[model samples]
Target: MDFNQLKQELFDYCEEINVQKVGIASTDTFDTLKQRLVTQQAFNYQSGFEKGTVEERTTPTKLLPKAQSIISIALAYPSKMKDAPKSKKGDRRGIFARASWGKDYHDVLREKLNLIGEFLEEKVEGAQFKAMVDTGELHDRAVAERAGIGFVGKNCNLITDEYGSWVYLGELITNIPFEPDEPIEEGCGDCNICVDKCPTGALVQGGQLNASRCIAYQTLTKDFLPDEYRTKIGNRIYGCDTCQVVCPKNKGVDFHLHPEMEPDPELAKPKLEPLLTISNREFKEQFGYMSGSWRGKKPIQRNAIIALAHYKEVESVDTLIHLMKKDPRPVIRGTAAWAIGKIGREDAKQVLEKAKLHEQDEDVLVEIDKGLDFLKVHTTT
Candidate 1:
């Protein structure tokens, strides 16, 4: 059987299926990635979300025993939202990053990968394949890079010429000995825009990231956010795009190729006050379709509180006070207490004093004290 001809056929099928980019790579152990992972682990720079051991992550053969080649696919998502709603003074809103704008990419990419796997099975008598999206043990970016889908940028994102960094990546590991494509020669040379502009300095160096300091990572944490990042997170509820948004390579790189990836203006940038009080059922009904909702409503609600504080949304003072006193979650109650203080309403001291009397949680009391301190500083002046 002519594997080269079969490779071309697979490529054609990918194009017909509307996959934006496709490339083939040999199933060689990723030595450099293994080293980097080890170093990242030692320095505590790794995000705990990573799946599998370092060996399973870097060695394709471990994922699929007889893996001979890997096929990488990328689908471009829209970077620019059309007719986005404005975050007016009284009705301020928070944004989900561009990656989370549309329907979840996991479901979309999984469907595409399954299609490719079926196609390969039909063509080859005994084609064995394992497909993976972002959650798989194998690093999607490493596989994509080796497959020549794109070069890894300083922001640690895979940047393709056709779609820049605004793309969802997936891969299929198969026993077919498809010829590997050459890695892209392009790289971010002396361009430090993403590094310089990272809100939390998550990008330690060009290609390394301290996920702990990353606003994207911080936004997903269930606990109360640290004091320093409460203001720095701005109005982002899920994920941070400062590094990607500022990259020159991504300039004018919006793509609307996939209908499922189109953003709904109101949902992607919903009003902050409503989010603070959104019931779990309502939160699910409104945001369940989006990828950013994976962490559920708590983190998003927490970020919403921080965003209201960032704007000093005086209109939300009443809602903040309600959350401070009535919310069941300690994190929410504490975050609301802090935000109320930050907003500094004329009666903030009174409300906080009342909350202080009944608050049982030690952490909530600490936040209430901080709120009173803010009032104390303002009242004396």
Candidate 2:
């Protein structure tokens, strides 16, 4: 069968199996785009990289030699609870939809991709397949666009007719060079809502992101945040999705029922008090498999403290004080100091003084001052 015939058959199979959208493209497309990603200043350099590894660069072809064509798929996970729920108000939670709240998409997508790979091998004669759910070195967004799934929006998310920007993507690489899929026409048009809505001015240009300024990266990727960007990071515990949430195209999509995507309730509308209270063992049990678990409890815990600080929610002050004094993780202690500043309580002042005396790290001391400043302002007010 020709490429078109094969692509049509694949799309049909996806619909039959309850998959939302599937698109195909040649492997060479990713090779070209990978080079482009490296040259762009918008890319955030990964923490550990001396030379060439997956961190430095990625090559899909190296993993799947027969990967002549790639099949990309998208699954939507829209929120069941409308308007992002008000668990911890004043902490924006930064618009992360249900899609990102559960187990990492890498694991979820890989399971589905592998299932599809097995099915393809059975249906198509002499077809050999391998799959990657962000593990292999492929430019997934570019592949999704090539497959006609959606256009790359100004927010850098793959936007689809059915799910808007609320979908997750995964791809399977195959040696069977089936018919190539047609690329969709770019749909961003003259709209720039994503750029305007970004709080940190992270969107450097059309479809470009400065990783340093991005709230998602700031909260999740950076181990130590520079003071200048600390206030801008907001209260996002993990990833940020403000760009997609405000996009005009993402209106009226139902993503709660996708076969492969569902939000874990704890993550969807997390309780800041409970999150702050969770023990390390419980933390591991609850989030060890989820997307943000790789960073462990420190970053997320720090974020919760920041959220409390941002809101001046003095309720968590005791929790913050405990974290400041006893938490072995210095990052958490430092952030707790910042939260103390936000709470601006006289009690917090005492804690901050003790933290200042005991703190050896220069960075942590700076955070103590920030907390003290908040108290100063509170006293003056």
Writing each residue's lDDT as its tens digit, candidate 1 over 70-117 gives 999999999999999999999999999998988999999999999999
- Across 68-113, the per-residue lDDT of candidate 2 in tens digits comes to 8878998777645544456454333422335456667777777778
Candidate 2 regions with alpha-carbon error over 4 angstroms: 1-6, 30-35, 41-60, 80-85, 88-97, 124-126
Clashes per candidate, residues 3 or more apart or on different chains = 0, 3
Q: Give the number of colliding residue pairs in candidate 2.
A: 3
lDDT of each: 0.93, 0.72
Against the true structure, candidate 1 reaches a TM-score of: 0.99
Q: Scored by Cα lDDT, where does model 2 land? A: 0.72
Residue 269, model 2: lDDT of 58
